[model samples]
Target: MTARDEIPLRDADQVMRLSRMGSFHQSRLSFMRILLRRMRNENWQFDAPDWHVNENGVGRAVYTVHGPSRAYSLVAFAHDLPDEMRSDRVIATAWDTTFTLFDGIPTDDDIARLAQNVPLQEAGRISVRELTLSRANRSARLWDFVVANLSAGRQPDPESLKTVGYVMRTTAVYGSGKFGAADHGTIQDRPEFAAPFQAEMLTVYLIRCFVMDLLDHNAKCAGGKRAVKLSPKLRRALGIGNSTGLGMAPFLVNHPTLLHQWIAARETALARVRGIKTVTDGERDVMIHHAKSAHINAMNWHSQHPMQIAKVTELQSDMVMLCKEITRIGDAPYPWDRLYRWAAQNLTSEGLEQVVSILMEPYGDVVDDLADAMSIDESAHFYIDGTQAMGHVKSLIAKHFDWALKTDFGAGDEQARFWYVSAAKLEPRLGERDAEQGHELEQPLAIGRDVAALYRAITQDETVAHFLRKHPEHRHILRRVQMVEKFPYAEIRDNLLHAQMMPIDMLRCKLSFFGATHFDPRSDRWLRICMFQNAPFPDELYVPGNWVYPEPTGAI
Candidate 1:
């Protein structure tokens, strides 16, 4: 048996705490890396057959990716959105750019139809032929700076590029039957999209291409004959940015089975890498290079939020200590495991997670296969097992949700926050239990409180069938308890309703698996992040690439 097979996965209690989940960093198991690796291995072909934008930057572009058995196209519409109409709220009626991922290469008829409706956003309707619907706004400050500099035949200052990280930030990217788009089941069978969010990832990837093309187009329009395109190096340095808010926090709670699969794949990958008995000099060098690169990423990551600012500062310091410690470790048995143990003892949560991320970079052969197991058939766990005895259910709840059962929801502080959907926007919003009008309409996001309630109600020994027959209100929570019994890493062991709960933690956990970086939380409820920020573009996928954290900007 392999050393990895002998090493057990980390306990759910340790892995699923909100604080630790919030500190998660992207690893080889991240969906973005998995998608890119597959595309590269399969030798997918890409092309932009249409690019028709005017001097005013109002036009359409189509980027298509042709896999072995199918093709998908990103149809983008650029608008002359005045500064006043540009807002990030879902209620906003207009945006600088809108996009839809077409099931295949779109025709002139499809583009015309989309041009009329895609720009309308939520107000407009998309057909089932669309796989994903999305929109973005240019980074007003950096967009002009980059365009002006490139128009003047010079590259924008790299420091400014690093500060912003991406020229355009997406407001939303909807998939899985949202807004009339083709449901995930339509294309889930394709090998290219067997993993979760592959279509969404592909949409964002093509959107990055469109953003770059649009920037260059506008720069040339402004500079005329003197305009220069962004340098290849500078271009690759930019990624697609996203603004995520409370609407995403519920996803983790609502999709526990899938969550377990994702966390399991990553933790399993870490254990596999940790179990390596010895590392060659070449492997050590690769790990060192990635470590240095991650340090560069830490140095460049800028955030205005106070908590994130402190994290960035601590991470920068941690990287320095990491460099010093890397030199001290000598050739020995289970060297990778030894390093992990050292990190657990010496590094901050943020820094330790970063350490775990880089460690997996050099062992792709050991961990890449875990990507295939990250998707789950959630429906398989949907039906409640009525045969389970009440005592057995209580035991399962006590084991998986001991933290939940301990929460004192009677205290106002413990139930200070409530999640509800906004009537104006119909999206998730966090409201104060004491001050907001919607506390009575709260969603069942307070899983911990509900579990505690269930524990109290099931004081006597009876079958789950009897309890459910008497009180159907507890059925949902009962199903969850039964499900968690099998899926170890399924529950977030924090009080979501607590006044101190950071919804950003939930957002960060999900985004980390998407391979995002430069998490700049604007508020506790929402944050900004960059995707594929040092990743290779579709055109560059054919070339040997090292698009990992802390890219090798010559100065670094």
Candidate 2:
């Protein structure tokens, strides 16, 4: 494609809006897909060298994956807790299972040491030899149903599987030095973990494997001679579930440079696909197949929250419209770009972003490489140019923080919410500014509001160095302001403290990048989502195809 035919990346202001970002769908660039593609290409091998669980399901098992140059093992400890004690809250002290990803294969002594700590979760301490620490609780209803049916030599009802996608849902997956696990810096240079969250994603992937095996073992013990194994089709239908809350919302705000890299890479991929001058017949077929599968996924996606219910309803309609539009693509130049422009005009933000994701499905060769660019050494962007003129800083604010400048923060609703860390768990929480206490200890996550205040504080033309001498409070935002001048997509262009701002939107934006689906919000503050649903297990990694969306015939 020539320069004239090539489309430019979408503007940050248009693309970084919280509403649009929340509407994003996973494409081939998602970390999970990137990790899976690499494992398959390298011909990784997976095995469970140790399975010590008894009939009561209270024992330990180790699942390990041998890669090209390294091996990581997931050390899992199963518990037989009473149903009343099982909870998904962060404060919960017990779980159905707990796990830690070891840097390499662990010996009996290493396993014994981990056995004492992994199950304790937050109360436990790990060493640098571990990469991640996590805990999960079983979906009591689905677990019971599946186990009972399988033990009696029967498959689970597909509709029941559809209603609750996973047998167990992880409440928390702590990594990167949290709870004393290995830091990202220690493992980042490794080829396997070069992409963001590959270590954690691999942990969850292997956990899924263990979860399936544990279920099979329990069924055999209960039924004796009549027990049957879960079919591969049903096994592929389930995935690891995750419960996320406000703790994740501030991440997008705290790591501006890293967030920019992710958004820029995705936008670049979309631009490249849109620039394609013509689509071959095989490429067109791939698009049609994924589009139909996306439609089925939309129809199958379930949520009880009114907001998500409405969004899913709109997405279903959008997919139908998209499939019909795909049928009309004839011998037109730049057909993908044409379809994108049509979507921009005709569809809602939800449908429009869906089209952007679907368009990239047929062009993996052009987009897959972008995954490598998703991660960065954020410390390189930490230095502030204190010598910059105050005039230049104000102009940067004018160009990037116009949305913040125009907002009326003095209004009660404009600043109704405040984010703060709870003293008990030290996790981020939101409170009503007017009715709630602890607004005095608010965190520095209200970036737009802070930028507005910084603009007002600049009263004279001088160097930023001199300004910081008198007012050091503006230092944090000043660094961010300078960063945004170089990275346009570095900031989320919205008021995070507004009363109407749904934290779920921020959570969904980050989770979608992790390749999560079935966003079921339990409330505005927290939600349940499924990861790797319809994805192949490690044993089936050799099978090649896009498995993010289910096949039409596989739909419930």
Candidate 3:
């Protein structure tokens, strides 16, 4: 068969299930990879125009990247946060460092203004010239080890680096009109900001560079002439860690159109790769090479949480099976499709999703363009079609939300949890419906439960406009039902209020799109992940090809 007879996209019923969504791995289309690829292709230039930190690591530095049309700078401020004051929670007011991604190269006067407010975070204010605001704390376990060893002119153990993964972990990275920063609408027209989260991804990438530089400077000051800089390979292995919590879980539910575009882009890429009628020897070899690297990545992945530990264990076994199976498959026609079909039946969801990511590794020419289509003007889909008949609406509900229709929301387990905004921090929080006093103030995140209610409320054979006038409570869900008709992957096929529901599953799904790796869950509500791990720094962007997985020899 020809490529024109491409494999159809996977059904939303199969792909949108929370179990499968949570099992997703980063692919070539991940936002981080997309940003890096663009930077490399455009021949972007990076430099540190100023570094004024003292031996105490208390000062400000500026790192800038000159793109084809514009220059953006990361103005980072280092603080001497006491051990007692350090915290990863949003309620905390202090951090080891705070940064903002300035829209362009900022002048000395602009720096003076930023210095006054950036460190105060939420309590501070920024102008529209800023794109993002973020803060990170040093890792308690790995920070001292690296500092002591580097100060003594010795390299920290690679095993230790592998164990902890990063010197600092960002507690939060705020953007998109947050804290007076420029709204996404202002920057969406720019070519560099075309893709979703490109600005935030760029901010994190530069932060990685700043973290390495700070470590080197602090070590030199402590040991005088005896200190040494980190080797390039070891530095490359370190990534910027992030502590993500329940606050991120609502994104996928709230931004239906955007979520659909992201998932649709990925699903399209997978279908294109699976449609290949012939696999060349070179393509087959590249697949095997990355498969081995993926195996090593899985082996080195560590997590203390029981759920993640079990998933990682299964992933390790799946990689081994995949390596042996891919080699034996040989040069068969439609080899990728054949391997994917086999994996679906033999492997767990974690391994099965990894196979999907690996299949696209050899076909960048076919899939990379999908990155451009990932962003959406969600406002265009906001208008409701009030003229549609109730029968048509019922059919749309049946087609897209069958899982919700089947669920018994009346049961205690089905409606056990409620999502709320915490009064103190104004962050999204999950609470027990039965035991909590604030169930009366719950947010409208229970899409499944609401859809079920909408289904019951639709007792008349009339237009949505007429039906809604009599029962206005169903207006929100009716808009969602209509939206899902055009966007198949828009709604997650699960009951968000179910007692067994894991919010980490929602967090993992979003982070994977950001190209995060090493998902170490701290609890059912939050997790820690490493970003740009094994990825090239700005100076090393000239080196090309897939860098998501580590070399076998260098594997920890």
Candidate 4:
């Protein structure tokens, strides 16, 4: 296929806007969805060769996954962790479980070597025989309840799930050459995992299966080994839990080119649908299906945080309104194009964007093609081509990102804060310069303030190259400015240091793309989200690609 044939031609302004990116929801183009697509297309087979979890759920287990080109294994090390040690905090030294993705079945010596380092997380460096590395902790309150209820030969109250959904929450799921695994460069060519972030998703998916096994085994071990397995429907409702904190905030800023690629692909997919001048009766049916599915999913979404609850409720109301308007023009020609116009004009940010997310579902042919090209040549677009004059650079910024320029960083509250990497866990944390300490080693994530600084410096420059020679340190921000000039949606529009900054919004933007549903906020700074809840299991890849946004009954 030619360059034009690869991705749809989208407006640079629309794709580059950060607020739009921050507002993004998951679509068929998400990493997890595409990875599942590739996995199923390959007809990957999974086998459980070693299942030795004792009745107490403290034992060893191994799952063998057979891909077309390679055989991989998930070697799990489960242990008895005291209540004090089972913390989800980044500062915690231990977890209820640790697992590694081996290239193939390991020898006894290999297993022994891994057991030494996998649990150490950041403290220990793993060597490169591994593909992905991760660790998880049990939900403190829910784990004991499941054990107690099952030990009494009774099914745990399924409603108990309505609160803290998953039994285990993964502290971190690392891949792409993390610790000692093969860096993405070495393994990106593997057809099974070429799509961005697929390895991480697969690791979590397999972990979900392992957790179910552990729960059932413990019930059997405590009760009479006659404990009933959870119904497939309830199992389908469960998801791999993720306790995301500021650990994820920096990634969106650090990987500019990759961020640009993700938003670019999404915008391109939407543009293709909006430009569609015709739709058959069958195509109209698909669009309506997506609309209703989205409405139900939004309605069924649950969260305790009032802010998130309000956002979801608004989305539900908006989805209903959208569904009503959608039927009015169902028989019209180019139905999807009209629907796009209506949504853009009427729906709010959460609702309109979510509709765009769902619309991509009905046209998998388009979404699948765009989703195929996930990896990006980020370095290729890294440098600021100095050929353009100072005026030209500033002009693009002013025209495309006037909102960022309007931010008043001079105010105490606006620039009063800083983001730091914690020494204990090496995770990101936000702090106030006046109210708290640690402003000395602030991370380079405050893009709005810095980009404005670079903008003023460039305006007074004699030449673009001369400007860089005098201020080489601002090279990173310069590249980002140049990139945002082309891909407008790449940066967040809001000031990060402002008192009203909702970090949860930032987390929601990324989680929604992982096909996460229930966004229960533990606090403004951190939240709990459920991933792969309604998603098809590894065994169901044989079914269809349109199983992502399941019906309300199916969507957890």
367: Cα error in model 1, Å: 0.6
Candidate 3 ranges with C-alpha deviation above 4 Å? 1-4, 554-556
How do all models score by TM-score? Answer: 0.97, 0.98, 0.98, 0.91
Residue pairs with colliding backbones in model 1 are none
Per-prediction CA RMSD (Å): 1.6, 1.7, 1.6, 3.2
| Candidate 4 wrong stretches, greater than 4 Å | 1-22, 146-157, 386-388, 459-461, 544-546, 552-556
For candidate 4, write residues 1-556 as lDDT tens digits: 1111232455655543444544567788887788677778778898964886665567678878888888878878788888877777777778898888888888888888888888787777777788888889888778778767766767678778745667888888888777878787777777776668877777787888888778777777777765676666566666778888888877777886676667667777887776666666676666667778778667667788887778788888889988888678765555666787787788877788887887677677766787756567676787778776778778866875576688788887788778898887677899888888788888887887887887777757365677788889777777787887766656766677776676776777777667666777778788887777666666766864345555643322
Q: Model 2 residue 25 lDDT?
A: 86
Error of 4 at 232 (Å): 1.4
TM-score of 4: 0.91
Determine which window of 10 residues in candidate 4 has minimal summed lDDT: 1-10
TM-score of 2: 0.98
Write down the TM-score for model 3. 0.98
Candidate 2 per-residue lDDT, tens place, 1-556, comes to: 2222468999999999989988988888888888888999899998755899999988999998899999999999999999999998889999999999999999999999999999999999999999999999999999989999989999989989988789999999889899889999999999888889998899898899999998999998888889899889989999889999999999999999989988999999889988888888888888888889889889989999999999999999999999998888777898888889989998889899989889988787888889999999999999988889988999999999999999999999889999999999888999999999999898998898999999999999999999999999999999999999988988999999999998888888888888888989989989999998888887778876667888765332
Better of 2 and 4 by lDDT: 2
Task: Please give, for residues 311-341, the per-residue lDDT of candidate 1 as tens digits.
Answer: 9999999988887777677887877788888
> Which portions of model 2 show Cα errors greater than 4 Å?
1-5, 553-556
**Candidate 3 lDDT by residue in tens digits, 266-298:** 999889888888877888888888888889889
